[model samples]
Target chain A: MTTARAGALLDRLGRVGQFLWSGWAGLAGLALFAALWQAGHERYGDFILPAPLATLAAGLTIAADPAAWELAGQTTLRAVEGFALAAAAGAAGGLAAGYSAATMRLARPILTVLLGVPPIAWIVLAMIWFGSTDGTIITTVLVAATPVVFVGVAEGAVTRDRGLDDMARAFGAGPLARLTTLGLRHVAAFLFPALTVALGSAFKVAVMAELLANTGGIGGALAAARANLDVAEALAWVLIAVAGLIAVEYTLVHPIRSEFERWRNAARPWGVKR
Target chain B: MTRETTDAAPSLTLSGIGHAYLGRTVLDAVDLTLAAGEVAALVGPSGCGKSTLAHIAAGVVEPSRGRVARRYRRHGMVFQDPRLLPWATARANIAYPLRLLGLPRRERRERAEQAAQRVALDRADLDKFPIELSGGMRQRTAIARALAIDPDFVYFDEPFTALDVALKRRMQDLVIEAARGARFGALFITHDLMEAVRIAHRVVVMDAHGRGIAGTRAVPGKPGGRDDGTVYRLVAGFLSDDPLFRHIHDIDERRTP
Candidate 1:
């Protein structure tokens, strides 16, 4: 390669290095979290609280076990399925409710009642209705997560820039084009943050419902660990569930959210170009 | 310089236009005719229903009592503010009308680029969103958008009122060029008599109460080349000579006993 071409390659490598360094900085934050865990371990006895290293050892052993994979997969699948259904339902319902005042007035009270009932109450009902199956876990997750997503999407749609809508209308844009392009872009802004919270809620509600219903998952594994008084194993299962949540969030949801929000950077003086 | 000698009728005509809002009478029986290839500047006070008249002509708002006859193919509008899409780049905003017409993505991009070039937007600026551009650049993008579909007529609702003086004058030059070159009839609304005098083939004056069009005065020069001295002379003559134009400065003399 020519000297200039080689120099450009080096410049690209330097940018890659900078990006990796930023990720390493995030790892440093996890190290601080480890130190706090160590503090908690030192305060309590071995039976009550395990050391961070001990939990790591337990987590690794669980990761290697074939049965543990089945538990992990069930929990992840149910949580994901539940969250996806809620997101779709919420988005469509919210678009309708946000655009129409009559729908909003009717939905507001119904949504309020839905949000008021706890997931545990729903789990009891779900268990009685669907038995100790994946249905219980998934239903609980959906019930817990849907209301938050609906509120965010509804507010986003209602607060859209009417002027922009008028501009689009004057240009003769069809209804579908205007809704997808103009309406959805604004909704995504509110939807992403709500989805983050909802996803987290979905996992928590799923795990709780599984434990209560005694369906096979990380929650069942934790219950067994608790019966045997294995603090390290219980904590290990909790850590695995969280790691899955973070993995899905950072890899799937976050990238999509950032792609939609890329336009906002242009408004800033020092824009964050990818 | 000359009106269309072809057999085609006027591009737009407002016949006995009248409008009222929420039981308040704003405009009544205002008749105006804009021929093909002509620019009619509407000068009146802010509340003199100038914008209302423009809106009525553009079919943006239906008149309470008259008919608007549009003999043209496509009509475009430029508002006081740039009113650009915050998310779209300058080129995309310019190409928006075409997109609405269901053009393909590649064609839209090409047409948008061509439109951007018409308003003298640099290649770099065309890719920048509205918030990234200067106010003048934003307005230019708006104008580019207005002219993109090869409109037969355009409504200028005080489009340049938000720009700086120098930028406004530059924009006026662009408008004049577009007005003449495209042969599109325009209904230019403004409160500034100087702006109206600079580019209008005919200056339409409204009564002080904004109830009706009081008079119409034809400017001596063509749309693009009027000298400031001639504009000043005509403005002076309108204020001093015409009854409705004179009403702007007159303080009702029927006040005392």
Candidate 2:
């Protein structure tokens, strides 16, 4: 038992080392993107597009202030709250639709209508309903993020292995046991990727709604920069928003997803390693 | 005079079992019984509804008409494919049914390891995922999973049909040995007469149209006791001369219900 436990620990450590090592490739990709940004800045001039280094300096200056931190934190909190609600509602709805044919048929047309309406349109509607507050930003984020998660989870549920279900039944598993053990585990593969997409949109829509609703967040800071024609400061706020997204995606979403998908890594060839 | 014969009771009884998929009838008026500690190899032609019958008997499919009575304490099953959970490690896959039964984690682990050892699966291979294991090892893990439940009866639905010749023989030997040691009754379903003659105490052939059981032939000796020459001769003789096995080799995939 001790040896088995040790082996599992070692396996986990190896995967963690591999994950950290893969950051080099991520950094290289980022550097390439920076090179493209620099080329754009040099061509357009500072007034049109600030240089990457100048933006970083401005972002650092903003980061030094305690008030700027609150602005960033307020936006993060709104986006994360909306994302949590979306995940819960979408998963429940998707699981319902996936297991029942009648529910799936009904949900499809409604989902189509939901996806067909633009996030901007919903933001306008939410602004009218909830006014210029956190409510407006959160409502817009929920509308934008829920459909992505719902579609992914529903598809996951629909395509589950019937053979496995039969195998489970033959072993005397009841419906509830089958659902918890097999159905949920199968759906998780589809859930994580949908969550990543939904999360990305959650942050994007939160920022957009904050700007339109005139709530005091990074969006409000951006509005101030726009009023004074401070292009570098606006770019710096955008940089900070993107940095928050990266931090949350890496620290929260990616780690949990990797833990669930470690078996997939074992299937990969040794030479490919990724 | 009344006699107490609890030991002589059948492990399973299926009476007038019938099934249909959509509107198409796949099985009709089928009845089968398995006595305690008897390994019955059910053989039939392709598309003969043999698998459907197995599924119905195992309660994986609800029969359109009939009754199924299982007297065994608990049961386990192995399918044609390994059916090991791809996202789980081999050890976890073996322990899956135990988890379903709500066994404590420690006992689950111990039983899973013991089952693995019964199938001669290497201890190190238990940690690997289904994708990491070879075809033979994966099937072995599946068999181990079935054994882990400590079942009094088992259902094997063409469990070794996917393996190569040598691997198939090895798996058959493993099942034979396992059945001998565990003394569990089993309903072994396969289309191969040679396999049926090799592993089963009695070989049952189903009707071509799945109307009913065509006939049954008792093998001369216990499974794992018969020599290769005896098994080969019996299969050949049945194929060439036995009227009951005339259509056992027939294949029509389009006719499968």
lDDT of 1 by residue, A233-267 (tens): 99999999999998888777876775566567667
TM-score of each predicted structure versus truth: 0.88, 0.97
Per candidate, the number of residue pairs that clash is: 0, 0
- Give me the displacement of residue A41 in model 1, in angstroms: 1.8
Residue pairs that clash (backbone atoms under 3 angstroms), model 1 = none
Q: lDDT for model 1, on a 0 to 1 scale? A: 0.83
B1-257 in candidate 1: lDDT tens per residue? 22333344788888899998887777888887788877888887667788888877876677899888988898888988888877777888898888888789888888888878888999878767798899999999999998998898999989988888999899999999888878888989987778898988888887656567877777787867877788888788777776656655443423321
| Tens-digit per-residue lDDT, B1-257, candidate 2 | 11122257888888998888888888899888777888999999888899999998888999999999999999899999999889999999999999999999999999999999999999989889999999999999999999999988889999999999999999999999999999998999999889998998888889888888888887888899999999999999998988888888876857744
Off by over 4 Å in 2: B1-7
**Which numbered prediction scores highest in lDDT against the true structure?**
2
Chain A of candidate 2 scores what in TM-score?
A: 0.97
Residue runs of model 1 more than 4 Å from their true location after superposition: A1-21, A270-274, B1-8, B16-30, B62-65, B206-212, B246-257
Cα lDDT of model 2 by residue, A65-87, tens digit: 99999999999899999999999
